[model samples]
Target: VDGEAKVGWPTPSKKLELYSKTMADWGWPEYAAPAFIRSHIHWEDLDLAAGERVLVPTFRIPTLIHTRSANAKWLNEISHHHPLWIHPEDCEKLGIETNGLVRINTGIGHFVIHAWRTEGIRPGVVAASHHMGRWRLGDDKGRSWGAGKAEIDRDAEGRWHLSRGEQQPYESADPDTGRIWWRDTGVHQNLTFPVQPDPISGMHCWLQKVRVEAAHPGDNYGDVMVDTDKSHQLYKEWLAMTRPGPGPENLRRPLWFARPVKPLATAYVYESGGTTG
Candidate 1:
């Protein structure tokens, strides 16, 4: 039955279309066909130094949700630490041990985490899971299953620092709290990354070209430092890359593109010579 039948896609022409009419009509003919566009952390654009490596920070562990499984005791016990996954070759070249501490420097800040050498990751690239790293300003606040206590402060230069405190066994209504076996809640590396949205997709790009070096003096396992001022500047830089909308017929967005929730047809049309609210 399968050999006798033929099937095609749902779009017009009933086949895969490399050229997109929607993109051409929306004033983006250059992107009508599939093509590679250089990104903020593109390898050629990064020109990484000896110690610098591209960090793929948005990868997720199969067992956990995106930063939401911290409240689950079983999941926390299964995977507690979100260690920096470095390729074995790169780790050896940089003289990094399996459990050695490494500081990853981003555009606006740096995060200190433990390096775990593994062949599962690609050479010259490092990865860290988005799970874990849940923290509360004080020990009394937040859930105890996967969150740790941290002290945050701002210096004279407007730099924010988050220093993690030890997670000690505490007496609570839940007896499991007293049997806590792990001290590390991982490092909150996302706080150090700046917003870098893709121009066309508008999705935040999570990959970053960062310098990975031995942890500096006084650097703790979960240390995270950021400069909000610089982060804001980066936000503007990416925002500037976007092309103005109000395409043909003064439509705010391409009518063919799917949105989370479809709005009224009138909402798609912007006022003459004015942007939509």
Candidate 2:
């Protein structure tokens, strides 16, 4: 971390990379270096449903890091809810009062959550810090102060229906069980998001443009409803958007990129027309 400017960065060339040949070779010369890849959630790309808009799912509060800190009782106490943050103007436009329950519909599923109207966010944008909405399902009776449990039921044809169960009060070794403070166990909105894999990075496009509508009759907090069939449908849809499947792209991720360790040279031998492993 010290005095490496003169020696160069720990890259293949030991020089800071402005242009990534790996990206160029992989078909995205535009992003081979530093350049803005317009976010997937722009107004032009979105076909919003009534009362819906773009969602900023990565927003985080000072108290936690994504869903990992949910078990930290103190941290959870400080930040227990991932309220749907909206601009006050947009909230009015959508008829959503602060703390009002709203249903967010993703491409794959939908979840109900409380709206939080504030001037802090941009108009037409709904931000939900993803870390807070943690739940447990099936036979798992109580809120894990951290993890989740679910209630699972099967029908005549063996189709399954899963729903969120209450965080039951239970006697536990930790005295805090009796005093578990905040009960706003958030929704598992992540389930609702369909996989939008990036053609270059091999990652899900997490920033989603979704529709946020007023809660209809029978919507509840911590509610998540997914149609696995629909999810798979979207999966295939986005899968077709990728450039090429993962494998050695002429060379795997550019041998120059700094990694904790390197693989053998033979590992990078995937030919142009060969199957990607």
> CA lDDT of 4 in candidate 1?
89
Count the clashes in each prediction.
Answer: 0, 10
The stretch of ten residues in a row with the least summed lDDT in candidate 1 is 6-15
Q: List model 2 lDDT by residue over 1-277, tens digit each.
A: 4746476676656667787666776677778889867767767676543665888788778888888886687887677667888898877777787798898888867878889888888887888887866666534354567554555555565433445555544567878866865556666778778888876766778887788778888776667777677788888877776666344445555655545787776666665545452
Q: In the order shown, what is each candidate's alpha-carbon RMSD?
A: 3.4, 4.0
**To one decimal, what is the Cα RMSD in angstroms of model 1 from the true structure?**
3.4
Measured against the true structure, the TM-scores of the candidates, in listed sequence, are 0.88, 0.82
Judged by lDDT against the true structure, how good is candidate 1? Answer: 0.84
Number of the top-ranking candidate, with TM-score as the measure: 1
Worst 10 residues of 2 by lDDT: 157-166
